[model samples]
Target: MSPHPAPDPLAARLRDVRVDFGTRTAVRDVDLDVPAASVTVVAGPNGAGKSTLLEVVAGTRPPTSGTRWAMAAVAFVPQRAAVPDRLPITVRDVVSVGAWGRRGPWRRLDPAARAAVDESMERMEVTDLARKPFFALSGGQRQRTLLAQGLACGADLLLLDEPTTGLDSDSGERIRAVVRAEAQRGAAVVCVSHDPEVLRIADSVVRLVDGRVVDGHLGAGATEPQPA
Candidate 1:
């Protein structure tokens, strides 16, 4: 037999991935690659492992039996915006969540971290909401706030799961714009959505059925397509 192919450094690689949950298997023998310089959308029905895939990549969950190779400096934006800190926290405080990975347990913010968080909040358009309570924000505002948290991580790879889930059309549009801009700034964006419209702006689309990928080809779809 020929030698096995080498891992692609430009991509996040998972080979022979399997994740078992009690009596059932959530994902099995899943081999995938999410490449750099592209927005790859993972689409699947409910319980089909789309979110699980993201979670695994985010280091929130580990695969039961396989190697998961995530690119360095990965940012994760979960579906239900997480206020990892308590509610009532200010937007600025919430954005600071992104810095957790960059800080040591005993470390405090230095001038650099302060500058990073400031820049992230501004990019998410939450600088004005900095003093506002995170829980008091509207759904759209909350979404933006969470994105600010992800941005503050200052990672070059972002894993966003249904980033526009609860937003109104305008809010969703704004979120999409920010996501697109992040890629232009040299970040690799990976999004999981059943909404093909959300996948429209993606550089490629991968369809997952029952936790198995059906396609992983570059998209020929229209550029800058808007979600319905």
Candidate 2:
């Protein structure tokens, strides 16, 4: 494993972020910095508030206390994207939505946006499924489509939750490669994953327990890399 370069400007910064649902505290007093051109993995057991923390960083949920500074452009892929099986949408349609952020909701995808869409689908190895109905694809294929969508967005910040969960080893590796490529391209990639294979790609690892960050480390020995 190579050493991670000195971290660049932050994609997102959190200071004492706390998220609470009425009497239930989902996350508490958390502070974090997501740096560009690097992969950061958030890992922990269920109910550890890993997802909740990710949501805060993604700007989907407001924290009860503290400050969060996020980049102007952000893309997020939730653990389980609810793509209705009956929706009349093709793989291309799903990937095209990624460009909606850049082109605006009303504008048709121009040549540049179209090219990005095609490139992203190819990066995820889903170009062959371009015209296929999204619902007809297997779980792993659907996951790849969602990832391709995120990549197509061209956002500065990418947040993904358990992207490899339930995926076969090959499918998982494909996802990891794309994510690493995104980071190398200067996008800050934050992922919530438990799979050691997925975690191995992280330049930094943040471990949470009971809604608080128990360990956050960067570079070698921060996380013990697992064999491929």
Highest-TM-score candidate: 2
Q: Which ten residues in a row have the lowest lDDT in candidate 1?
A: 1-10
lDDT of 2: 0.87
Clash pairs, model 1 backbone: none
TM-score of each: 0.85, 0.91
Tens-digit lDDT track of model 2 for 39-109: 99999999999999999989889889888888878999987767786899999999999999879985899
Off by over 4 Å in 2: 1-8, 221-228
Tell me the tens digit of each residue's lDDT in model 1 across 107-222: 68777787888988887778999998887788789878888888887787899988888778877887788878887776778899866567778887877777777777676452
Specify the poorest-scoring 10-residue window by lDDT in model 2: 219-228
> What TM-score should be assigned to candidate 1?
0.85
RMSD of 1: 5.3
